[model samples]
Target: MNQTYTIKEKTKQIFVLLIPILITQLGMFSMVFFNTIMSGKYNSSDLAGVAIGSSIWSPIFNGISGILLAVSPIAAQRFGEKKSNEVSAVVRHGIYLSVFIALAVIILGFFFLNPILNKMALPARVEKTAFDYLVGLSFGLLPLFIFNVLRSFIYALGKTRVVMVIMLMSLPVNFFLNYAFIFGKFGLPELGGAGAGFATSITYWIIMGMTWFIVKTQDPFSSYPVFANMREFSWEKCKEILQIGVPMGLSTFFETSMFAVVTILLSKYSVTTIAAYQSALNIVSFLYMIPISISTALTVLVGYEVGARHYKDAKQYSWLGVLLAILIATGTGVLVVIFRYQVAGLYSNETAVINLTANFLIFALFFQISDAIQATAQAALRGYKDVNLAFIMTLIAYWLICLPVGYLLAHFAGLGARGYWLGLTIGLLAAGIALSIRLIYIQKRKFTHIQVKEVV
Candidate 1:
């Protein structure tokens, strides 16, 4: 009865923790969906431009975000150990490092944007549109980077509500900006697809500014100055941040590169097909965040448990997180199955896009479950300061397995985009199983060691 009740409690706890995050995740998805819709509303070229812009820029942004994410687990572990003051230093250094990295991206993006877009075999109209968007977005990269660093600090402190709040506040701002720019409302120039990028760029700075305000005024334990002190910069701190962040950054590159490469391959099919793929991918990305939120919670929980030397509890919390992820994922899968058509229709009206996306959702349903498991397990591993394995696993899964299989299935087998998704599904399944077993083994070993030490 006690075990059953404990399990029930964990379920309730996870729901409480993750539901808000899911909402926040949806809000984030709204940012993507809204941008896609705005572009699509204008014309196919507009939509294509948005897709191209994302494909080109997302990898760089994702890689930088991954690097900064290293701070969360480290902060969580330190916070768990009751070293609360230590977190301030982590936040300070994280901001400095993220800014430095963002500046690098800015420089590279400015120099490479035109050449790269020009080289792509895109339509002249779409290339011009995409280039404008890319250049506009490049300016906001620093704001996004700084915002993400602050957000990571919030996540480390188990204050996901702040993210949800910021996302909520940003929606109206984003929508208004989209209207003002895309359609030339409020005296803004009608920039079409390029307007979508411009609005996003402007919104990013506002969000960053607002986020900084909230962190400084609202979050009590976070003591970093709104503008970082130049004196706070240190070689050791930057190196430490990079030590934890670089592997994560590389892992993101491996995963995102696989997706981007597949998109490039799929582009050969038809514009309609690529559009359908992006639509489905957008929804899948939102669904995947359910587990991601759980993982965030688990990172804090497990790290706290470990730092406190409560080995058994740490192990239990990891299991709790995994179970929570599966249960929530299964529920989400059912909803996707039931409302697949309706969901697809929300983003687009074309019969082909709706049909293809519905089919993709069928695969996406299964994909989410395994993806959740893998993400949660990986989060547990992060709590243990075991990120190196994630780097190895992602490389093997995405590059060695997923990418190759996707290429073969799409090209040689002539199965098209569905084949590419199937390859991703297989890769996710492998990662799920591998990560789960590894977490269980490592946690058990740690528990046994704790027991022996207690005996001594």
Candidate 2:
């Protein structure tokens, strides 16, 4: 008789798998928070610039990042099949494609920057500042591209801890760069929003360099193929990456663009409101890193299990990941509700900013459960290589359901900023339900078919 792996062993493996990812997420989120705080301190307008600027570019980068998802599955499938050289080829192709994608975005972004900003209807100052920030931020695009390739490679090797280490190294460097540029500390000239942009650009290169170094030195299990001179790029592999990646990228872009659209709408309000909204958002965004980590881990595990033909285990691992995400999100929600004021105070000293941020933070707490559920489910879907479905679900939830409700609540109902928060809640709730149902149906069907075959 064959022995079955115990539940404890499974749980332990999943936890161990997730821990490194969680640490990496936290470290990266901390760097983001540092930038936000630095911008806010320089001026509220600067903070708004970061928000708007990031919104404009995030979607494009997200689409590129989506392509990297192909690496994990392709690498994992090959790893499972014991096709070692093919795994290296996949990673090599992923890096080459990422560089091309990044360069394309950079070139196009420069040409499109003015038009996009104009369409956004940003205030004169905010628009100009954001334009400069984005253009300067564009310098880091190549680095971001390289980092994604290397990071995905690390993830495929299951040495996610390296990601944690690299991010850890980046935190201090990011802070020091922000400090130097923001305040002209240590003889650095004050660059304001432009300074922030330059600081971030430097940080991106540092991260990429460090991650690449790790790939070369520390990780002996990597499949970095030698295609530098002799190998021609494969359109077939590129097409496969695009098929999975384009949808995933569009999903992130759509969701992020929704927030950006709302931010533009909010710009019609006082700058104080935008500042408050950004602060609250920054805090919530940090908390969200937890679920994002779980999702990343789920994607890896689900892909591995599916490739290995462990139908039951795939279903089990995916659900367990969701459960774990919910528990973490719930605990975070409770803590946020309890210390909403203190958390707000950390970002700004203004009474109005603090009050408005605290209120939104309360609303943010209400949606944490659904947020966790949806994020984990989406990750599981990605793991299943069902990227297109995930894209559609996000579209319907945000564009059809959330945006409409938020507009109605904010404009028609006079909820102001509160209306936007309420709208976000509705959208997240819809996404959570839809994604969960999708996962459950897929799991049940797969499991039933497996059981039926066993009986036969």
lDDT of each: 0.79, 0.78
lDDT of 2 by residue, 353-429 (tens): 99988888889986677789888998888777777887899899989988889889999998998898889889998
lDDT of 2 at 247: 82
RMSD of each: 3.8, 3.9
Model 1 global lDDT (CA atoms, 0 to 1): 0.79
Q: Of the candidates shown, which would achieve the greatest lDDT relative to the real structure?
A: 1
Candidate 2 off by > 4 Å: 1-4, 34-52, 117-129, 179-192, 217-219, 223-230, 268-276, 348-356, 413-416, 446-456
Highest-TM-score candidate: 1
Provide the clashing-pair count of each candidate structure: 0, 0
| lDDT per residue (tens digit) for residues 277-332 in model 1 | 98888788877787888987787667766776767767877888988888888998
Candidate 1: deviation at residue 17, Å?
3.2
